[model samples]
Target: MVKKWLCAVLVSWWCLCLWAAGAEHAGEKPLNWHENAFFGLHFDLHPNAGDTELGRETTAEHIREMLEKVKPDFVQYDCKGHPGYTGYPTKVGAPSPGIINDALKIWREVTREMGIPLSIHYSGVWDSRVLEEHPEWARMDPHGNRHPNYVSLLSPYPTERMIPQLLEVVREYDIDGMWIDGDCWAALPDWSPACQAEFTRRTGIAEIPKKAGDPHWEEWLAFHRTLFKEYVARYVAAVKAEKPSCLVTSNWSFTVRMPEAMDVPLDYISGDYDPSFGAERAMVEGRFIASRRVPWDLMTWSFLKTGDQPWTFKNAAHLSQEVSTVMAQGGAVFIYDTPQRSGRLNSWHMDVLAEVARFCRERQPWCHRTETVPQIAVLHSESTWYTRNDPLFNFGGANQPMEGALFALLESGWSVDLLNETALAERAGQYPVIVIPEVTRLPEAFRQAMAEYVEGGGRLLISGGEAAEMFGELAGITFA
Candidate 1:
């Protein structure tokens, strides 16, 4: 009973604030996302098999009102979610249940009429519906059982379903772009018969590594990463060929979570950040992405949430502080607003966004696609990270020692940028000091590179036990 009251009160308070800050936008239209757009908004209803009121309450007036007030440079609306169902009446894909009307059509029309660029939130790899419909396409676990959610990259899902759906949407609706989600982060190693045959074919290793510590584990892992990267590249190429102007990106593909050298042909790089307090996450992600030398944005969940608590909207001041961390490092800002099941804009939440927008715009002159003035250099090593990180993409909730190093630097008042092996290779000698944080496994090639840098008068700080032992050759004196 108390929980119900708290939820009701939070709703009332949110609505009140949104109503209070009902400011209108000027006559300026938003710039193209590929060109230069610092601020954006994303909404995904994530309709499942049980959704009963899809498109019931979404109207042009409500959408127009929200767009006019928020004035985002680009808007990513719901099309398909992890459940593998389209929100609208999709001819090429499965539409979610309880579609009273066309909600996606409404969003596209309203945004088009208002001149706001629109993109769809499309899920890749992690589609439950596809797994349910065709179990043969499912990934085979190491124990030879069918994995629950992901489809095999070697399967026909991409050609028959994923790519066709993407091409259909852009061909039919003419939306600006697509934001592919559930990719990379949801990827896992596949031990299917086809994958196994190919794995042996490519690596010349007859036996597959069951887990992380197997004899040829690194070779097995490297093979999987290459294949998954090919899967992403295939779809991106299809999208570009179909509609050359359409923007596309796979979430967390090149970010710190799966930090590789920027090898994929992404028009722009982006990831919607995790919902924990958000300020800390923005700082770490912003610093790494800034070093990638591309246009990127870090998203914030405008509401605070943890465990099973109700989603409560964060105040503008708190949101601003989070955005400041990203913008200061020259990263674009995107806010995710959880949509009501009824498909209507909650005016109260718009009020919070209005205030946050003002704060970001005020500091736009000094930030947005700017470079960090390079002070302290920290290596977020891809080779060292992938060496032992058994999981394909996500670290499975492990706290990063590299992040802790960055925090220590911040507390001691030094400007820092988190860089991958590729970025550091380009400008290694620019920074005075390079700190390698607690890396247990580093390639011999990188070790030689670091030794050369140190020999050339570069100051190297090797943190943690294994790193100290490995880099001890540079101490220039023997310890007792």
Candidate 2:
């Protein structure tokens, strides 16, 4: 009996060891060129109605010229845009009425000749054609009316149409990857019958909230957030299942817009920074993406607008500055440009991009794979951003004290990283100082993690009355 018990225990121990080894291997992935300083171009090709004749030969010549001049490692040309029009001839979906030639095919062939990887900018959730063809796929509002703008992922269109179309492009084109646009950031609370039924089935909450202030509003928003996240995961899995080597990512997947989305299996993370906000936002976004241990690049628009009008091309000096901020935080850079409706390249824009590329090339060695020694970490509560819609506390609050705190820290020349609750809990001890930044509502686990961090001799710089009230003792302050 004793010998048999010992044999059983040894077998169990050996099985546990094998399970651990397998778990570790599951998390490992091979690094690619995207991990280095990749200078890329994102060409937007949404032409106006009158500009239908997209001179294929001229466009190819322009692409060749641009490639020769700019020398980008990768180029993301438009396959589909927010308007839900395909740049290439398609049997599945609506091709742009204005496009006379298959521009995507042309670009793919040219980029292949140039020995550069080509990625497609395909709109995911915010597709207009899906909404127009199947109104049932549109996100329904409180009034039972469909939103004309974006498609609901909870509907059947994503599985039936979106994923299949993505696979179609991958199988047909000689493309490297896909940068899926308008995913999590464009998600809305869907009250469609399918969504409601699924929500009720999952949560057992029979009553659905109609408005923001209604009971269970927070729960409803949380459900929708998870729904969009799951949708992205499904799309990524579907694409990879078809083409395992095909890299895939949704815009703003790991950025401030949807930090939790970093958990999704993406080849990389990227987003176009608002040129109006300048380099400050880039710096903030870069640090956030870096924390996720993934390759990331932030794109800057070529033209900066004054109000509703496009004023002028952002010069090389301005662009170089933006690139500097991204690189400083250990990220690559991509400059965004819009091609003319007639499929002509702007020589002057090519010159500007060349100059920017030269700047990145010179600094690539120091910037690539460099580690950021974070001195401070600011908590960016994704939960707070999702559930709470108060103008003073939510997205409209200008990010409130969080932005203010980050700005002050940047001005003071302090290296900062924005961490969500999960990251904060896991990495709280790594930072010498952690800032709460006026957050009122926080999970108990995160609060306890901070407390333990402080007890372990980590410094805490917390702002706001609510935070002060909760952690006053740790900061050696008495609250009334």
What would the per-residue lDDT of candidate 2 be over residues 290-384, giving only the tens digit for each residue? 87778888899888887888668988999999889888877888998887765667889999999999999998888865767879999887766
Location of the lowest summed lDDT over 10 successive residues in candidate 1: 23-32
lDDT of 1 by residue, 194-258 (tens): 99999999989998889877989888778888888999999989987766557889988888877
Cα error, residue 456 of model 2, in Å, equals 2.5
- For model 2, what is the alpha-carbon lDDT of residue 411? 90
Candidate with the greatest TM-score versus the true structure: 1
lDDT, candidate 2, equals 0.78
Which ten contiguous residues of candidate 2 have the minimum total lDDT?
387-396
* Pairs that collide, model 1: 18-348
- How many clashing residue pairs appear in each of the predictions shown? 1, 0
Index of the highest-lDDT prediction: 1
